[model samples]
Target: MLNLTSPILSDGLTTRSISCPNYSLRGFVNPSSKPRPLTAKPHQEIKTPHLSAVAANATEPLLFSSRAHERDQKDRRDQKDKLVVIMGATGSGKSRLSVDLANIFSGEIVNSDKLQFYNGLEITTNQMTVQERQGVPHHLLGEVEPEDGELTAAEFRSAAARAISGIVSRGNLPILAGGSNSFVHALLAERWDPETYPFNGRGSICSDLRYDCCFIWIDVAPPLLFEYHSRRVDKMLERGMFEELAELYDPKNDPGESWTRIGLWKSIGVPEFDRYFRKYPPQKTREAANRDDWDAARKSAYDRAVREVKENTFLLAMKQIEKIQKLRSAGWDIRRVDAAAWFRSALSSPDGDGGSGGRRCKEIWEREILEPCVERVRDEVFCLGEKQMTATYY
Candidate 1:
């Protein structure tokens, strides 16, 4: 039997010794008994006798090796390219966590959020700023032009596949991150029959994945998530979301610029503000004079639009959560990390307070969400214990 004398090293090397009863070296002869004098001259090449029998019996020890050999065989049999997928609702910090994991794993992110595919409207779609990305390369983010029209799921799968291949070629992990579960489903599903199983139909999107996936699902309580979404909409407005939309609100540029049309205009905030923009044109024409009585009406319309944006955002979060649940039910081994406590603490803390509340919330997030996710990803990449692969919420 082969016995591991010490713990397996972190580098996967083991210090093992074989212990067997009546196991002798078959042809290991004692050179001392032969009394062969070393008569070789200095710096001369010495020829030693080859122990062919001992060399032939070298495989005997391995035959009695321990479970480590079995484990190595299993790893070889199941070896597949690894992929990390980060999924969550709108305000659940999926983008932030993806960035963190990519940094940890020497990874590059391939965005799956369909809304974030278009150029401009960064605030409306909540695309990560270059500064916020912290220099980690991101793919398919704001690469599509507004006039280029909406990208289909199949098209996204093709583009994302190329990006993933490129990232893998550069010896980096590919992290598929965003709230667009449809794009993710498109790219990861092994066999998708669009005709028979329509995207929105009750078809089972099986998890016969193309790559070995480590799915990290960030979950927040619905009440806390809704409250967080409402606050985030207000934050977006403060960050000049309205002004950004105003710049893109040129109905004269294209007759098909309506929110109902397929394209960047289909974003939640863009459509909701359509009426407000019509009532109060961003650039008032000289022919149009503003009356004092219209001021109250315009303000009311603007406030109503903001309310609708918040409501629509909440609904979108709900739909994203439902899709994630469906993915879990469809045989995907998704690891869920609960950030509801983090959200509650963050919501209670005043924004820009520069106090311990903000720091404490960050601590909670790292402990409850980020650290667990990092551990899970580490285990997957290293082919560690199966106990770490359990589908339990952290």
Candidate 2:
């Protein structure tokens, strides 16, 4: 019978013993010692190359084991196939940030804003200008025709999925940026439950995510955000927003019925200006001679419409914020970056302050919002070399 026993030596090393019945050969093998030939000639010496020497002398490329290679491929796929979602209220700079991140990450943006999806009403929907896009490719922005029909959440999910797949197949990051929470939920949630899809408040929506996602929430204080929205409305007006609406307006169509049409017609400024447009038809307003009471009534109606746009915009921002809060409460790992300071600075700065105020606001935005978000995205996507990025609640 052959017997084997492993015993701890005095040096804390494990040694194995082999024994036989007829001819007992007892030896202690030190596992940590260099391996030796089982049998050798009387006057021969065996030399083994040192590990470093072997590596230095090797001419062929080093190869990973089959298992190691497979693991490496999986890691590469995980690193490449990631989604960055930017969610926030209107006028929270979501579009600008998306463009900036796409530039840094070599990504393509997929727009999720419901209103921005439709064509026309560029100014009314606050669509980004070609110059403002900074040469980054944006998907689904101004792609839909309002006269066609309303775009459902499911349809958006399908289109967005295809866009993301194409972006990933081209070895580019897919960045979904917008304030359309319903579309966002529809796309990212693992399973769809129509009744409680967007804001279940029960934390069921994000229980299982469909993709590896990093969500960024650009947050601002309510008062400052509302003030910023008002100022933005004024800027849009200056940029011929009313003219864009006028081009779409037709005296033959009923203002109330036209406003009720799905898609672009439902945009904030469009419906809000219905009464004003009806009262003062574009052509008639241009042809009518100046009369005190008539002009006064037209001006009053115009002012009221403008005020309604601002008020409705404020209310929309509130609802967007509420939905975002509900999402956060429901276990979405949303990274919040407060932008109230930047808004306050921009709002307080005197108009036309030699461009110094604009520069200062940009600096603040970079420091407070952009840099942190970049770091977070970097950690989420590229930091896989060191550790995996996992969602953290709250």
Candidate 3:
């Protein structure tokens, strides 16, 4: 049988095919450019230039073998494809540690935080900085518009999967980072199944549903979560939350496919209040009778926002804790770190009490929270790689 691997094709004619008599018969030869006599026979021996030399050139085999070796090297490099999904309740420190670990592991940050995907409101959404991104590369952060309403967990998972693939293809580790617990769980497991319920997207999506991926839950406490959220909103306000909210109000600058479709335009819904305020601007002085009415309306809107924040955070915390328990029972590597340690690690340097304060917090984080998570991810990746190798060998 002919060796199909060889580049040369052999015919019944043993002579070089290029010098065949059929070539002259077919008018292929340049008679003026070559010697007058050209010899060819249909059944004669044909010796292609490389045919007689391939056996002597060991480099040819070496080049062929190099392809397999190249694949092996690529496999080794991509063995780090196993993802470390950092999940927590709202106000938990998922984003902080995710970014830090990404830096450490030559990884890319996939934002699982829903709010942080918007175009503006960096402070309000707590989006990462260019310096923090550090050419380390982050995906999905600041990629959406504020008006885009109620992007479901399914949408987040799809975006995350694409982001993860892009990261892995570029030979970087993918760190799924966010405080949205459902987003993290769903992406890791690839289970988009939401609970069957009455209203649209209202029912809880069960994390126990089967999926081809993995889930890691970062356990956090309630009190710390409350405090973190309260402080976060306060900080956002101090950092010009109103200005960002105002910018989103332009009737002409319509942000289609945004949270606005679901009627969630502004962060605090303050723009809605602003609309009210504009319709009935506060009169110059208390002499105006309707001034009291306007002030009361304004305060009511603000108070409503505060109430909403508090209520939403509580419900999210409860749901997230339940999800964590489910993932743990489902044979996932769920690591519950010290809540205080995780909370402290989220403090940015300037926000830290002092240099020493930040350093101490960093030490605790590396020792208690982050190190263990990294170890778990590495172990899982190695185990999966071993399984794949065993299957290939068989």
Instruction: Show model 1 residue runs off by greater than 4 Å.
Output: 1-55, 58-78, 196-199, 253-260, 285-294, 352-357, 384-394
Give the deviation of candidate 2 from the true structure as CA RMSD.
Answer: 19.3
**Candidate 1 residue lDDT tens string, 255-359:** 354534666877888878867778777776223433344567776887899999989988999999888888888789998999977887878878621124657
The C-alpha stretches of model 3 lying farther than 4 A from their native spots are 1-81, 146-155, 190-216, 250-304, 341-357, 382-394
* lDDT score for residue 157 of model 1: 68
The estimated TM-scores of all candidates read 0.74, 0.74, 0.59
- C-alpha local distance difference test of each model: 0.71, 0.71, 0.53
lDDT of 2 by residue, 123-199 (tens): 99989999989898888888887776777776676677777766766556789998889889877876766556556
Q: Give candidates' CA RMSD values in order.
A: 15.4, 19.3, 18.9
Candidate 1 local lDDT, residue 366: 79
Taking all chains together, the TM-score of candidate 3 against the true structure is 0.59
Q: Please, what are the lDDT tens digits per residue for candidate 3 over residues 12-66?
A: 1111111111111111122343322123222235557685476677655535478
